[model samples]
Target chain A: MPSLKTLIPAIAASVLLAGTATAGDLVSYKVVDYGIPSSLTGKAGDAAAGEKTFVNRKLGNCLACHQVTKLSAHPFHGEIGPSLDGVAERYEEPQLRLQVVNAKEINPDTIMPAFYRTEGLHRVLKNFKGKPVLTAEQVEDVVAYLKTLK
Target chain B: MKTNWNRITLIAAACAVCVGVFATSANATDWGPYQVDDRRSGYTYMTDESRAMQVDSFQNPGMIWVEQGADLWNETNGKAGKSCASCHGDATESMKGVAARYPVYDEKAKKLQNVETRINTCLEKNMQAEPYKWESKEMLSMTTFINNQSLGMPVDVKIDGAAAEWYEKGKAFYYERRGQLDMACKHCHEDNAGGIIRANTLSQGQANGFPTYRLKWQKVGSLHRRFRGCNKQVRSAPFGNGSDEYLALELYVKWRGRGLPVETPAVRN
Candidate 1:
């Protein structure tokens, strides 16, 4: 057995190595299939309605962190997150949907809430009551609009 | 009418100043959150005996956590034939001034470490004990005991040198949008501070006084638990309890409130 002094360094090193390895491949994973479903498909989500979801303080409230096109009339935009101008080009419709519905399904260590998963996480809202905040159809609509971001 | 308008404008300006002064006055109370008195001066103020009692501490649920911590401090654990006391020798003296400087950049680990992470390191190696799961009661209690030693001291997280990189990383974590709500820490704490969200008033959300007792949580919680709570408030997914991102954010927030007193068991509205 390693001495206590030596063991700590070893454990710390392994943890650091694991973190770095995961960080390098951050972008390659698929987000939607794990649990999140596409919000855009079939009847197609209305971009206008989706836009409302992006800014509605009580509902989607996306503007609280991200900066989108201000010309569209959404106010009180924040710079904490990222600019959403060209997101559509970076991800497919299904991927976009998955991120919206549940980013953690892709990254367990994420800070994104699962808008779609209704049950069985340790510290989620009881209002979700074992149901996702948004329906599969609603997710499709949001995904459709998000895909147009580029 | 022009004269009346000028008078109204003057009155409005005076009102703004008065409100500002009043807000600053509340910050001056030394007994309040973060050990900041009415002037926002960061000076910790609690008698040693008062510090020992959970009820006499800040009105938050963290008092309960501190109580639990006190118990754990004396309890024996692992193969070491020791409690934390066996090695530290009276934490009130040995551990003083320790809490204020943490989330230090470890050259060996090449990562930031807060008090809890460091304690787990001790348990795993020094004590030959199994590490407590992150956010476990055992971990929280031990951390609270250690930090209580530093009560009334100003937080002193050094942000220069290699620690600077960790600070920046923590800042990015605070600002990044990830979960469904896509909200950052600045949204609720900075931009919307003093505003009403649902029923809760958005505080400036400083982390100077943590291991705090929040009425909303009805329990003593770590800063990372609060981070998780904030993520949930925005409808975003939360990071795991002890993830590096959360630790980095904790480091940054501690640094941001650097001069503030350690309000380990502070009460929050």
Candidate 2:
């Protein structure tokens, strides 16, 4: 474990990154084992807004793979990933947070995109370079919404 | 009466056990999700209206481009004052089954060449004309016309000999992840081929119906154009229309759709 001296700069950098982009950036996070133990935005996300983000075609698009029976009102919930019917019951917030941030960390072969990571990506277009697919807050929002699946 | 009831119960229990065994085996197979059991063409995924549009030549918007190409074939241009008709003559006889065998290993160029490149090669060498820009009206029309000749012919691109190296490269490219989405072609086209992504149903990304008239574009477009669009969707820097990368990838994709009838100028949404 490093001292607060080493940690302070890293936290400051994340704050600076978050400040640069109003709602989008690759904010730093600490991954412990198979999960990120805290909120990426350092605050609880809005569950309502998270649900909207979850179903939004251009945003989370979690429905593109994982089916959520609660959101059956929306057309075409894909079967590529396991259904998130009782996802909240299966995993804690931390585990879900890590899964959203970068599922490749948990399962390397997973087709799921890393929603909050930008490093080591290949041939990213000019407009999306150095940008995570989902913002830190969006990641939290998705995690919050996912927690409501129970 | 009691014996008959017991027999009925035994038969019902056996049926239940059989169903249980079959269900577990089916679940264990793991066809990657959505379980696409057979190869399907992009046409199968399109709406009925789109399907109808492809079948009727008079109604098919691509037929317009095919007609345009026919006119271009006979029109003389460039210093040689030669039209495609001068050398090739009747295209119906000569160009038949030509597109199906293309993206072939060009011995002279020492690389793979698709129908588009082959067209340009003839324009430069035989006609002494400037090569039409890829995605240009002339190129799209010409390819649509040429590919139409092989409408029902199965794609049979050679992957052996010198073409073998390119094939391996293409296969690697299909599986290798790229872009901000970090998706390989296989992630959607293979693993989730029949699955829905938003409103759109993902096809196997077959090349059987290329130089196709897509409803989204509202016009005829080349295979390379579609490739660029997919790469862009994944937030990856798109390669050039006729780049070596796309050529190799195309060859690989064509191989995947081998035995599927060519549906050039086919309508798609």
Highest lDDT: give the candidate number. 2
Task: Give the clash count for each candidate.
Answer: 24, 0
CAPRI docking class of candidate 2? medium
Report the Cα interface RMSD of each model, rounded to 1 decimal. Answer: 7.5, 1.4
Per-prediction DockQ scores? Answer: 0.05, 0.60
Model 1 chain A worst lDDT run, 10 consecutive residues = A19-28
Q: By TM-score, how accurate is candidate 2? A: 0.84
TM-score per prediction, in order, is 0.56, 0.84
Every model: Cα RMSD to truth: 15.9, 6.1
Give per-residue lDDT, candidate 2, residue B263: 84
User: Each model's C-alpha lDDT?
Assistant: 0.66, 0.86
**Best TM-score goes to which candidate?**
2
lDDT (Cα, tens digit) per residue for candidate 2, span B1-269: 34798889999999999999998986663423112346567887778798788889989999999999999989997779999989899999889998788789999999999999999998998888999999899999899998998888877889999999999999998998989899999999998886877667899998888899998899999999999999998889999988999999999998887777788888888
